[model samples]
Structure formats: structure tokens, C-alpha cells
Target chain A: MSSCEFESLEKCLESHLPEAELTEVKHILFGKETKKLDLPSCALEAASERDFELKGYRFEAVQEQLRQPRRIRVGLIQHRIVLPTDAPILDQINAMHTRVGEIVEVAAMCGVNVVCFQETWTMPFAFCTREKEPWTEFAESAEEGNTTRFCQELAKKYNMVVVSPILEREELHGTLWNTAVVISNSGNVLGKSRKTHIPRIGDFNESTYYMEGNTGHTVFQTQFGKIAVNICYGRHHPLNWFMYSMNGAEIIFNPSATVGALSEPMWPIEARNAAIANHCFTCAINRVGTEHFKSEFTSGDGKKAHHDFGHFYGSSYVAAPDGSRTPGLSRTRDGLLVVEMDLNLNRQISDKWSFKMTGRYAEYAEELTKAVRHDFKPNIMKE
Target chain B: MSSCEFESLEKCLESHLPEAELTEVKHILFGKETKKLDLPSCALEAASERDFELKGYRFEAVQEQLRQPRRIRVGLIQHRIVLPTDAPILDQINAMHTRVGEIVEVAAMCGVNVVCFQETWTMPFAFCTREKEPWTEFAESAEEGNTTRFCQELAKKYNMVVVSPILEREELHGTLWNTAVVISNSGNVLGKSRKTHIPRIGDFNESTYYMEGNTGHTVFQTQFGKIAVNICYGRHHPLNWFMYSMNGAEIIFNPSATVGALSEPMWPIEARNAAIANHCFTCAINRVGTEHFKSEFTSGDGKKAHHDFGHFYGSSYVAAPDGSRTPGLSRTRDGLLVVEMDLNLNRQISDKWSFKMTGRYAEYAEELTKAVRHDFKPNIMKE
Candidate 1:
């Protein structure tokens, strides 16, 4: 039996553990549910009929799209969770839900059609600890999780597609996954995709928590556009992005939670490479502020793991297919980046580059066809 | 049998056309032999067991390599051939040859063990004209051509490996190939690799000149390191870079003659991505200055071609496996950029990232095995 008794999640963890009735979150916070947001008026440049601009970051040189422009307003939220280690995981998540509600209300006012959060946004990143007892409390089913329910309410209220990246899912009998769930604007449960690539280097020993994703490059169709989610580490794989493009993704969202030292220099690079190579718009989101844990740990390299894991560097930016980029959001502060792009730019850039016309997929198909055999050798020079 | 009989080349290109014997280039420059170089003392930062620095660009934060730092000094030369369009092709080539000898001597004095010249270093990029009369005269046999012989003498004298990209080889059979001949440090021919990808867009209508490469990814072994050349257009393909990495190429050089408007925006991007993704060093070289032809042509985009194509933008650069890059050479001036790197950085980065270990080749093989089927359908979500 588990030590804590909170909700159905506690029961889901064990067949023999005692269960407790779930509390209604709205019943706990009655007055704060409808709280109004007070923010800068022109902070958001909505995707209305006329062209718009904001102070810090603005787009440049809009080219004509092949088809009529399918304009959509997208909001990428970067937030850092603050909670004590000993605090109940349920209450910690509740605090995050309240903050997200405040941001989503403001995004609705700015007319955002879709919003995405950083990887495993609902809980703190505890994979570095390699401890299972405390972290397992955060995992919930995609269908009945508290986060899925919270996002569904916001989706219906604001008529926006919400891409809620959370630590989800069932283990392959004994493992957990870093997953992202897509909720449609109509409050329907659209599908979910897992993180295909896992990192095992210093500070990012993610294989301790989740294995490779089982989902094969899934994209969702909402009211606004065809979109795909390439979670954190998968951004390193070009073919991962190409699969989404072959499936016809106009916009790709890479929700990541990486620190400064591990990849700050590369933050501006990988996604932009994907946008150029795949001829699609890419939104790269990263969490802000420094994350600290209760105890120091070792990084498996005999070095002591400090309490703080560096700054998240929340410099979220959007890149178009034609290589044009919007100025990044503030690197130090919490930010909600709202970007507007004509979806037709995807088709136009693809037409001009002629990559699909001449990609010679047949050639790659033949090469990969031979590569999949169990005895396949990658180095042909030796053969 | 031929209109011009200047040398052995005239006999090779003549059937029924009026001919003249080709002139021996060494004979034309009667007294002008190979000159020695006079440079500063610190210009040659040889990998002689000491850390060094140079003007224009320097490396940042050198990490300890997994093995001994297998440092090699490499130089990439970006030079433009200058002469009037009506000038004889033979004389124009001789001018380029004289200038190259001077630059190469300087490179050798600087302790550069391996050097690469820009695409078709001895000839004009006349593909923009779409007219084929004079450009065909630049074709030569890779086995015993004049360019090959000139590079052989330089290689033997300097004890350096030379990669000479040229308009080679089959004008007799009504076809021309964009090829690069690799001459060993001992001056022996070390095979060749043809350009794989062909461009058909505006300004880069190279389909008029060559067929796709019949040779697979070929890497040459030299005293300094194993090297491969991905001739200009192949840089756009990530798979091409991956192939070279799989074949064990430590340094891959891309020799190109692209203008500013078409690919300048992409210049800083693709090569860096290849270096990071493949865990290898990449050297990118492009010709400088604008070349003009006597006749105007059409781009097939309904726009008539002007006398000059856009600027070649000679910003040659080198990128390390860890994503550190040397400052690019001058965009408008001819330059020779020499870079020093530890070959063991490749193994260290690969070990740290472990992409090859966890890349799930069996998984990708299964996916690609299915993807290559003629009736394979991409995963698309319908509304």
C-alpha cells in the first residue's frame, strides 16, 4: 500500500492499496477560478485581419503564400514551477494549474487559437534524481489525468486547442514515459505522441525515467491547422521532423526544458534547421528560471550534483520556412509568446525548394529498406 | 580534326571540329616559376604540441579529447577566377593557376597539411548562361589532365594533400561532370567523388552540366586524416552528411560557388547542423566576387538573365563537432582559412551524446523498411 491517499491516481498505482475520493478542484478554489489578468495591452500581436507588430520582437518580410493564408494565433507558455520537495505532489500540481489558468485567460483575451506548454509542465523535472517513490505520483492516464481535465475546460471556455505536455502514461509493464497530450478546441481528446529520443548524457540521464517513445510521429488536425509535437530530446533527430513533414505538418511545437550549460548555444539552432529543412514553421519553447531540489546528487561521473541545475533560459522563438525568425522572448523572465504566421508559407517554401519534388524518397526508401535488417551494417566502406 | 591544336587536350576534344594544339602552360610563363612565400612568424600555428591563436577567429574552451588530440592543420581556399569573357579559356585558366600556386605556397609555409580549392577552381561558372560552347572547353580528364598535373607538382613539393575540384571529364561523349580529384601528399591520384545532388532552380541550373554521382560516398586516407568531399549541392542533404560519417570521414569539405541571394541565408545554418549531428568537422568553401559573361540569358523563370549573377559571397568557415565554429572568412574578399582541430573530439562527443547507441537502428530500420514501399502512406489526420 502507498503512504499517501489523495485521489484515484493513488489507487491506479496499486491494485491492493486503499483508495480515497477525489476532491473537486473548483470546489477548493471558488473565487480564484474567474480571476482577471492585468498585463500590458500591446504585449500580444494577435492574428487579426490587419498586420500587427509589438515592441520587443516583430516578424519581417511576409511573402505571399501559395494558398489563401490560414492565419492562426499561437501562444507558447514558458513557466517554472516553484514548490518545496516535501510538499504534497497533488497540491504542487494544483498551484501550477492556478498559474496556468491565469495565463490562459490572458491568452484567450489576445485571441490565441492554440497554446502549448513546456515538457512535463504540470510537475517538476525529477528524472535526474533517479528516485521512483516521489516522481511516480505525477504520472496519470491521458484520458483521466487532472491536467487533461484542466486543459479540456480551458479549451472549451476559450475555444482553443491546448497542447498539454505532461509526464504521462503507462510504463511498458514497468516503465514511465515523457508524453504530450493534445486536447482539441471542441474539448475532445485528440491523440498523444511520446518522446521518441531519450538522452543519457551528463545532467540529462532521462533513460532512468522514460524509455524511447512508442508513438510513430503522430500529427493532429484541429480547427486552425495540422500540427505535430516533437518533445524535447527528439529535436536532435532530423528524420523525426521529416516524418512530421511527410505527414503534412504545417507547424511543429518543440516543448523543451533544458538548462543553460547543456545546450544554451544550440537553443537557437536545431529547430530553425528543422524549419528550413522541412519547410514548416517551428515554435521552440523552453522553461525559465533556475530549478532547485532538496538534496544534492551525483551525476554518475563522480561529480557532485549541485542543488541547482542552472537556468532554463526561456528564450522562446518562432522560425518560418523561409528562414525568417521572430525575436525571442525574454531569457530571464516568465513569458507567454504569441506568434502569428500565414500557414500558406509552408506550401510556398516547399514549392520553391523543390525538396519534396526531388527528395528522391524512392532512393532513401531503398537505402533504409536495406538498413532495417537485423544484420545490417551501417558502415559500407568495410563491406 | 579540331579547330584549336594547343596540347594533348585539343586532340582529346576533336573529332570533325577545326582544331589547334594546346599550349604548354609552363612554356607560356617562360621565366615565371614557383615563387616562395614570406609570411609572419606566428602565421603557421602548426599542431606542434602548443595551444595557439590567430586573427579573425579562434576556438573557445578546448575540452580534453578522448584520445590524444590528433590535431591536423587544414586550409580552405576561396578564390575567384578573374578575366574577361572573350579572353581565351586557356589563358584565363593560367591566370587562376598562377594565383593558386602563390596562395598554396603560403598555406604550405603555414604548416597546412591538407588544402581544398573551391568548386571548379580553374574555370568560370558559366551555367547561368545556359549556352555551352566555351564552358565545354574547361573539361579535362581527372587521370592525366593539366589541373591534375599542376596539383601533383604542388603536392609533391609541399608534402601536402590537395583536393582540386574541376569541370571534369567527359566532353568527348557529350557530357560534363562536376568532379573533384583527390591527390595524396605523395602526389599519387587517390580516386574521385562526383557531385550527387543536382540543382534546377534559378541561377543553379547544373543539370545542363552533369549527371548524379555514380561513385558512392568515397573518403580518402592521407597522412593527416581521412577526408571526404561533398561537392556543392550535396550539402543540403543531411543523409549525405550522415553517409560520410558512417563511412568514417573525420573532415568533410563542401566546395561550392553559390551566390548570396539564393543560399546566403542558409550559409550559417546547415553546415553547423551537420557537424553537430554527425559528430565531425565540416569545412565550407565558396568562391568570391561576381563573374560576368558576354551574353545575357534567361533563368526559365520568365526573367531574362543579366550579365552578372549575384555575388558568390566567399564566407568560408569550419565547424567543430561540439558546435564551436571559426569566424567565417570575408564575404567579399578571396581568402584562405586554416583551422586546427583535434580529431578525437568526434569520439568524445559521440560517446557523450550516445546517439548511435540509443538511436534504435532496429526501430528506424523497421519504420524505413515500411516507408520505402511504393504504396506507403504517410500518417495524415483527416478532419
Candidate 2:
């Protein structure tokens, strides 16, 4: 494959695959892990391969001194997109795959320990159309999906934990899911979390395509950090975040595809709230810019059919356990935000908040059991 | 009794009470409900017995017209104090009682239908001192406490729903609770909700004072609105908010006594997040200024004994169901924030966000059942 010759992520993939027999190849990496201290540390950056492009990038570091250091450098990539309106589904997938790989390479070069992408990063947010013809073809298997395979190679090559969010297994029928594929630094397919809360409002008629997730809140204990993915609309659910926090997630990524008018006001709130309440680092990622389709569709409102789903303002930011946040990325620009801080901040913050120990989880669980009763009796009164 | 000598709401009370045996007295209001065709209209302000103070006041009207307007004006009052440290318990109680009554007058004059005072709004936040003797004397009955009677009179006087959060029923045995007394607009004692989440960290050793709530999340269908109070520390628990929302709380008041350094950062987050998630208007009230105690105590740290907790930082604000927020009250001054908007905004925002309809509650209920299981396994992978 020729290096540095491609204009987009799709062209980068064409050099690696002949298109017909791509499944015969498995993901493998040749780059060595730059040996450094295994624990989260401020001095964890090591350059095993000195590429000139990579050498110039410096990580945006949080200067919080830790009482007991467990540092992890996390990266979140928010990409603006441009795809020809008439492009085939395969070409679109190839473009996304190549773009994400490039972003991961940049994150790895900046010595990011773990990286996460936005929700359904491979394709445009097409549910607004509600006409489910070609969009269904974008769904692939999590274990051997083209997106997963592409990420696995990058994960192994960079020795970085990768969270690849994609639409999964939908084309065949009755098995579609919005999933986040968690890959270990060594290219092992660790686990996947499905989008638990499917939004069914306005342009987000996601329930038409995907049901609620069957996979419960799963925290992957990767080599870099213990992470969980609360996919897209799941960001609205505090219980979704609480369950992950209960399962001992040090970091939770909310990869969302929300636009300005539908959810912009709510964007800055939910994930940061989850971070503070759960005492964990939270990464909120959104796709940037506008994606217009060749076909226009009706919103059932009798208004003129529109091609775009509004702007997916990609103001991605990471919130620390202490309720501090890194500056948000630009709304209209494609950018990668790297946040370096001590993971032990979780321990300190949790110790201060003491929510896990003080919270009446068992009691709440009991009430919830009663609340879900078939003949629900509300404990409410009126004069 | 000279009627004009009494203050705004207090004078309205004198007309009903006659300064006689008030227990035998059934409250008769001199005011009438000026009903406007509801769908949250700013023109709903109709005064029956208009004092100059009340006539001059108007609700902070939102211009958003409603399809089916169910309008209600909510008020949150935050107060500051420098109670004489050497004063007797009754003196402190009287001091707080008089101060809050004045604030209630302002709220009533503003035509606020529901008013919530800050957490334990009566006395100094003496819990930080950790001294058992004097503070224990402050706890009173949820039903017939001195504070309840004071609020009950005010509630009937102005036909205002009153939520009075207080240190309750602790002078005797183990019956102590951090509770909010809900007074119906008709002066009926609505059911109370104890603080569900008791914090147990640093200076907030509240578990030492009160156990978790047993009343459950109770919503009262008041004459003005369906309301619930999430007392102080319970604000940290989203499930508490969720349960209330499930029970159809249109407006949830979070009366809190949180100080600056310990929880000021979280103040803006928790209630606002709840408002968005639950599709309900949320009122977050906090005590203002610093209150000093006569005695000094250790925080269990090696530091010397301290005379006061940190600043209360009264930044009480109202968050709309649409994720918009009322500007917060001053951090260092006593202030009352009046939020007047359409109650049907909940219906509109919920229709837009549809988190209630689209969110997979039952699915989550089933999963949470297993999640709280003793033998639950985390979906995690490790090397």
C-alpha cells in the first residue's frame, strides 16, 4: 500500500484490499509498543517509530498531580464528513474506515492510551429519512465487521485501546443493533455494548430500525483503562450510566449522533452529569458538520422533504472525575481531542463523593422491582 | 388585630386566623383564583385581594404559547444568615421562622403557586460541627412541627403549595430524618419524603444523623401542581428523580444545604440533568451565605476544630423541561427566583425528546433486576 497518497479514508482502504477477497486477510500489526511504565503515568509517552508527522504532535496534558498516580491518556475523535451523494454503501463504509484509522494513528502518535469514536461513525445519521433501503446495507457483524477489522489493525499497531461504534448486523433481518466494538491494545476483540436507549423522537426514529440493546452495561478491562460505552441515546439515561459505574468503569464514552436543534441544549449536560455523579471520566463525542443525502425524505409533518438531519455540532469534550472538563473542540471543525490525566483521580473523587458506598442502591433496586409491578400502585397523595 | 399592620402574606393570614385558637380555625382565604384558559399564559395573573406589594409583582412570564396551557408559577427562595451563636434553640428557630415567613410573603406577592425553601432552611447548618446535643434539639415532626404550622398557615393564606425542608423528629429516639414537609394549598399536610441518599464523606457524615428515606418518592397532586421534593443529599441520586417523574411529578423541588467547595460544582448539574431526563421543571434551592456555630469541631482530619462550614452559595435556579434554565440567584446573597412558564412545557419537551415514550424503561427494569443481583457478572474482559 502506498503511504500518504490518499485524499480520504476510502482510498486508503482500496490500496489494502482488492475488494473481492478481503475476508481472507486478518488484521495484524508490525509496530512495536514503545516500552514504558505499565501503570497510568505522566511520563508514559515513548516513541518507538519517529514519523515526522507524529513527532510534531504534543498531547494536551492536564497538570493534575496525583497522590497515587494511575495515568491514562484518552483520545476522542470528532470528524466532519464529505461523501458524494451518489456513493455506494461500500464506498461510504470504506471512507469511514479509512478516516477513523487515520485519526487513531494521530491519537497513537500523540501517545494516547485509549481512543473512542463517535456513534455510528461509519455512516451518515440516516434514520431521519425513515426510508430504510440502502442504509440497512451498512450494518455489519461486530466480530468480523469491516470497521472492526480496520480498527483492530490500528489498535494493534498503535498499542492503543480502541472503541469503534458502528451499526451492526442489520441487513440480514431482525438482528440489527447499534453497537460499540471494544478492541484491546493487542487487537483482541474484547466485547461489545449495544445502544440501550433507542430514541424515538423528532428526526430520531431509531426505534424503527433498532430495538433496545440486549447487552447490559459492559465495562471492558483493557490494558490501558477500564472503559464502558453508553451508546448514543443511552446518554439520556442516568440508569445506563449508573449501571456502568456500578460495574467499575473508570471511563465511560458516550458516542452520540445528535444534531443542534434536537439535542444541542442537552449536549453539554448529560455526560458531564454522569461523570460527576459516577465519579468517572466521561468522553462525549459527536459527528461534526452536515451530511446531506441524494434523496430527500418526509418527516410526516407535511413540510417539504429535507436531505440533511441538521448539523451534528461536534463539540466533543472529556470531563474529569472531579467535575472539571477539557475545553470543547470546535463545533464546525473536524478535530481530535486528547486528554491526559491521572486515572487515580477516580479513586480520589469517589472517596470524596463516596456515592458507591453511601448510595442506597439495594433499596433503589427494591423500589424499582415494585415500580415495575404489573399493577403499579403509585405512592402519591392529594388533598 | 390591626390588619394593615401585618405584612403581605401575614396580613392575609390575620383575616382568617383572628389571632385566636388557630387549631379550631379553618383557614378562609380572602383571595380568589383568577383562572385564565390554561396552556401556560402570562395573562393568568388575576389578583383577588391585591396589596400594592403584590399588584406591583408579576411572574417572570415566558412568551411560549402552549397548545393546552396548564400554567403554574414556581418560586425557590434562598436566604442567608448570621444567627447569634450563643442563642437558645427556640431563638434560632424563631429567627429562621421569621426570616422564611418574610421570604414567603415575597413569593406570594409574586403569585408563585409553589414555593420551596432551602434544605433545613430554619437553623444554621450545624451538622458540620458533629455535636449531638444542641442540633438534636432542632428536629421536629413532619406532620405537626412548628415549621409545618408556619408553612401551613402561609399555604392557606395565599393558596400556595409550600415545601418546607427541615431537620425532623430527631430530639427523641431513632425516628430522626432529613425530611421535606409538603403543605397542600388548602393547608392539608401532604405526605413527606425523607432524604433518600445520605452522604457519608468528610464533613458530610449525615448517615450518622439520618438513615435513607422510607417514604419513597411521593408526588403530591396539589391544587396548583403535581410536585415532589428531593431533599438535600437526595439530589445526588438520579433514581430518586426518576421515581418521582414516573409518579407524574410535574415540578420537582430539590431543597439543598450544600456548601461551595464541597458541592458547588455539582449544583448546576444534578437538577438540570434531572429536568432534561424526566421532562419536568426542576427547582434547585440552596442556602445562602455562611453560618457560624458557637462550638468548634474536627472534620476527623488532623486539622484544628472549625467554627463554621464553608459558604452555602445560594445559586438557586429553575431548569425548564426543555433544558433551558432560569438565571441562578446570587451566590453570596439572599434571593428568591421566580420561574413562570407553561406547565405543559413538559408535554411539549417530552414530545420532542420522547425519552419517556421512546426510552426502554421496561427493558432497563429487567436488566437492572439482574444487575443488582448478588451473582451478577460484569461483561468485562481481562488479560
Candidate 3:
């Protein structure tokens, strides 16, 4: 086939390439190219071995013309849990496993190579008003934690990348950290990143529950494009987002557990802003469903006092690099939101905006570092 | 009167202090104080010329009890206008004056001390695609322009500080500028500011319509507070907003003709980001409604066609420095949005965020100059 025809075929194939289609295409193309054998003979032998039906299309002929490597189908699984804040921590973990397992199965059936969860998906928002026991019991060792083991089996079963957030416990330091563990399709732990900024305002008393994260901004070299995870509160700080983008992160996941009313106004603003500002597609997954937690309340008479639990409103969503939101998952319902996106759209947007090419990063660093100093006065007098 | 009774009266007089009703005991004591002041035998006799109304409570009595001046009610008028792309230049100008007059009347009824309009309120957004006729009819002089005369009359009738945006024509150089003129309550022109940055992408073809604004960032001192206007498209350049905030501008206005869809998503994000980043209250006024203009379109079938004018989704809003939208005006809406704000709130928010207190302006200046150079590269290697 001519190069122009090959290019057109590749583009057409990419348009509707499903997860399961990828594996079939890969096996047929690889076998034909490596063996230098007839495409029809290789396909018939491979199809028989795999018990696969060729359907109406001439699979053998189509395989003969294929030249480019088969692309993998990756799916993101962003979900929110609906558990009472006072429920047993173990129950929450088990519930997460069941739900995540179901999502993994669904993605696997669709032939997705990877599935990702939001930041700290297994626990209630303990930072929203510091309470002691929740932190003590919620923290778990990264390597041997129950959540990790569950994710491992799921990953191995589906043969997909399983990215999950957990309350990481440092055995030596006796402290907790907000972290994400990337388990390979083979169930091997690839690596993990600890959240950088620990917010300490409003309901976010993260500093009291755990120390600041140790890992700086980083990107993981997945089979897909270079991916990075910026935990919940870190999205508010521009420097953190910039670090990952400047390092060439094409797809960044911001798995968050924010609810409506308190931080909800900021929810629609932050992730989209980061996407546009950094020229990267960002998936901001917010936990759905309310978690009732008992808290002290004072009455109007100044004599009455009671304990109450407030509800957590959930509305998780994914924002494209061009600033359009995929139909957001219901804030009140438990469901999965799936979207088919062109990874190349990032390049198209970047070429148009040229934020990376035109961005003055050196100047930003100087201004940011100086902005943190208490005594550094602004030069208002100088025009 | 007892000190506790005097304190209650003081609290009641301070509007922002949270209004409270005096107890029966405190009322009795205050009545005694009023009686003591009213005694004819007392050396301090009431003037016969004084037309004081004693409805058991009076302004003089409240003033005497509270030593501090009453807080003035400041209102922010966020105005937006829909300019038809196909309409004649003079027709568009006439439409803007009528729309502005209606908004001014609304501001007067709301008891607003100052009504600030958006940047370049006179013309349709010609910057999107530069057509020369629009630039040819640019307002030649700020003082002698039609926009100025309209605004001056509105200011005189309403007794307000009217901020009007116009296309300033520089007669000597035959150049045009994006300028904002501040008119006093008595219709006297106070001062004017030229926009600093002219954006080049999307619909902002500012460079084609007018020369880059030459004046450095500065604020206009008004009776209400130190205020400044940063015209549309300037919000993207952080330094411009920083310069205004650093100049003791308690309140800054970002008046724009930006519509929804193409750049609308960026609208909600940029203004609030600027408010939080700079630690200043920002009022972002966007023109709403649709305009029709015929644009030549080249089709794939080789037929030339025309596209109708675009729609400007108006959602004018005010964002507090802490990034909170005021109660009623936060939503995306059209019409006159009246927000009663405490000027002192700016001080409170700035004190908390300390953007000015901690900002390192000198270091940023050095870095910005370096960044403008073509060869500067980011040092991403350093975490």
C-alpha cells in the first residue's frame, strides 16, 4: 500500500479503535510482520487458536496491509463512594474493593488497558475538622495494605493498569500521607507519589492528619502517554500543576473528594483553569454521595448544644484540555462516566495556544518564590 | 448612661457591625440620657434652627453614642452590552448609550456610590476579526467623544462616579488607544488610564484595532476608595493585574465584551484566579446577548458562503478576594446585578491573604524582563 493510503487507514482505524479490537489487531499484525508469512495463513491459524470469529470482514487481507504498531485502549475509572463517615474503616475498604472491582470488570470487557481512581478513594474526608481516631485507623502501609492487595488481584485479573489512592502509612516515621499507587496489568507495583501540599483552611485540616507529602511533582511513564496525578488540594496551587506539565505530562488525573457548598464553587473553577493554563487534559474525579459525620453544634439560645453529622455532596467530572466538560456523573447517584477522547487533541490545542512555547517559566519561578516571603513588599511606586 | 448601654447603641449604629436590638433596661438608660440632653436648664441648649425629629431614636443621638463614622454603602455596577457585528458603527454607539443609561438608572435606584462600566463599552468586539472601518471611526478624543458626553450627563443626573471605556483617538500621531475615563459625580472628568496588554489570539485582535496601551499601571483616587480598571484581555497577563493591586487599588474592575463558547469558559476562570492571586476584589462584567454579522466562509465543496454573527453570553459577576462570589450576584445571569459591598472587606481579605505583604516585586521584575527574551528556557531539571 502507498504511504498516503496507509496514513488514511491508520487515521480511520484510530477513529473507532476499541479496547478489544486493539489486542486482536496487535496479534494479527505482529504475527504477520515477525514471521514474514502470508497474512491469510497467520490469521487463520491465530483465529483458530484463540477461538475468534473473523465475522464478515476479510481479517486476513486487512492484516496484510497493516504497518503501524497497534495502539492500546485505555479507560479511566473515576468514581465516588457513598459511606457514612462513622462507618467501620474496614467496611469502607471492602466497599471500595467491590465497586472498583465491578468498574475494572466493565473496563476489561471493553478491552481497556488501564483504569484510574481519584485521590484517597478509600476513606472519608477526615481532614474536614481534625478528628484523631479516623487518622490513626485509616492509615495503612503502602506495600502490604489491604487496598493495595485488592487492587493487585483486580489488575492481574483484568491485565490492566490499576491506579488507586490510599492513606499511606510510613512504618518508620509513624505518619500518614496522601498517595496514589500505580499497579501494572501484571499486578506489580510500578511506583507511587505522595501529595505535596497539605491544605489547612476551612474543612481541610490535612496538616493535622498527616505531614506534608515527601515526593515533589513527578510524571509516570505508563504504556499510554506520560501520566501524572495531582492530589485534591494540590490543584489549588499552580506551581504543582506547572511542575507536571513542564515535565511533559499529557494526561494528568486530579482525583478529588470535594463536596458541594463548601468547596463546590471552587470545584468548577480549579481543574478547568489548570487544564487551560497548562494545556493538558485533566480528569477531576470528585466523590459522589453524602457521608454523614457527627459534629458538635451550638444553638441560638447559647444554652443548647447537640451533635450532628453533615452530608457530603458529590459531583465528579472530567474536563477536556480545550475546556469542555464531559457529561458529569450525577452528584447524587453512584455511576461511571465514560468518554472517548482523542489524545492528539492536546497537541492541537497546544499548537494553537502555544502556552508551553510562549510561557515565561523562569519569570514565573522568580515571582512565585518571592511571593511567599512575608517582608517582600511590592514595587507600587515603580510604574 | 451605663457603659454597657452605650456599647449596645454603638453596635446598632455601625451598619456592618451586625445590627442588634437594645434590651428594655438599656433602652430605659438611653432615654434618661436623652432627657438629660433635652433639659432647658442645661447649658447646652438645642438650636431652634435644627429640624431634628425625635422618634425616640435619632441620627444625632446615635452619632453621639458611637464615636466612629458610619460605614458608607458602596455598590458595584457590572454593566454588559451586546454589540451587533453587522450593525453600522454609529448605530452600535447609539445602542450602547441607551443600554448604559438604563444600567445607570438601575445603579442609582440601588443606592450605589460608584457605577463602574466594563472596558471599551462603546464598540462591538471588532478585535475578533479586524475590519478597518471600525478602527476608522474610533473615538478621536476622550473629552470630546460621544461616549464621554453620554456618561457625563448620566453622572450629573445620578450623582455618581461613572467609569466609561472608549476608543481614544490620538490626533497628533493618528493612533488609537484603549482608554477608560473616570467622571466625577458632578460630570467633571477626573482621570483616564490606557490598557497595558493587547492580546493577539482568538477574538482579541487588539493590536489591529489600536496601538498597545503605553501608560504604566496606576489607580484613580476616588472618594469611595482607590480604584482601577484593567480592560478586557488584560486579565490573562498577571503582571498587569499585579501592578494595579500593588498600587493600593482596593477594588479593581475587569470590564470586558467577552462572550460564551470559544472564550467564555476562560472568562469565569481568569477573573476569579486574578482575584485570588492578587488579593483584591475583582468585578468582571461581560456583555451578554447575540449579534448577527455576515462573514465569508470557504466550504470544502468549493462554494463560498457566509456565517451569521456570534452570540455573547452575558454573565457579569463580582468575586471577593478570597474567591467567594457575593450571595445574590454569583450566578451566570443577565440584567442589572446590584451588589452592596463593604469597602473594608477588601482590607480584611488582603490582610488575610497578604499578597502585597509577601509579594517580591523586584525579583519578579528582573525575571519578567529576562522572560521576554527569545532565548530564555525554563530550568525544569530543578525540582
The numbered model that scores best in lDDT is 2
Q: How far is candidate 3 from the true structure (C-alpha RMSD, Å)?
A: 17.0
Q: Which number leads on DockQ?
A: 2
Give, for candidate 3 chain B, the lowest lDDT window spanning 10 residues.
B52-61
Each candidate's fnat, listed in order, reads 0.26, 0.53, 0.08
Please give, for residues A43-150, the per-residue lDDT of candidate 2 as tens digits: 223212211111121112234554545667888888765476458888877877766666666676567888899898888888888868888888889989888898
What tens digits encode model 3's per-residue C-alpha lDDT throughout A289-353?
Answer: 44545775342223444442233334454555665554344444444434344456676566655
For lDDT, candidate 1 versus 3, the one ahead is 1
What shift in Å separates residue B250 of candidate 2 from its native position after superposition?
1.4
Per-residue lDDT tens digits for candidate 1, residues A285-308, read 888766677877666667766876
Taking the tens digit of each residue's C-alpha lDDT, what string does model 1 give over B1-383? 11111112112223212222111111111111212223345444431212122223323323574445677778888877768766998999888888788777767777788999999999888888878788878889887899999999999999999999998876467667899999998898888878877776765678877777767677777888888898887777766776677667889999998874446656666777788777888989988877888898766666766887766867688877665666566655667777766677677778887765566656665666566577777675544
Judge the docking of candidate 2 as incorrect, acceptable, medium or high.
acceptable
Ranking by DockQ: 2, 1, 3
Clash pairs of candidate 3?
A293-A309, B118-B255, B119-B255, B288-B314, B293-B309
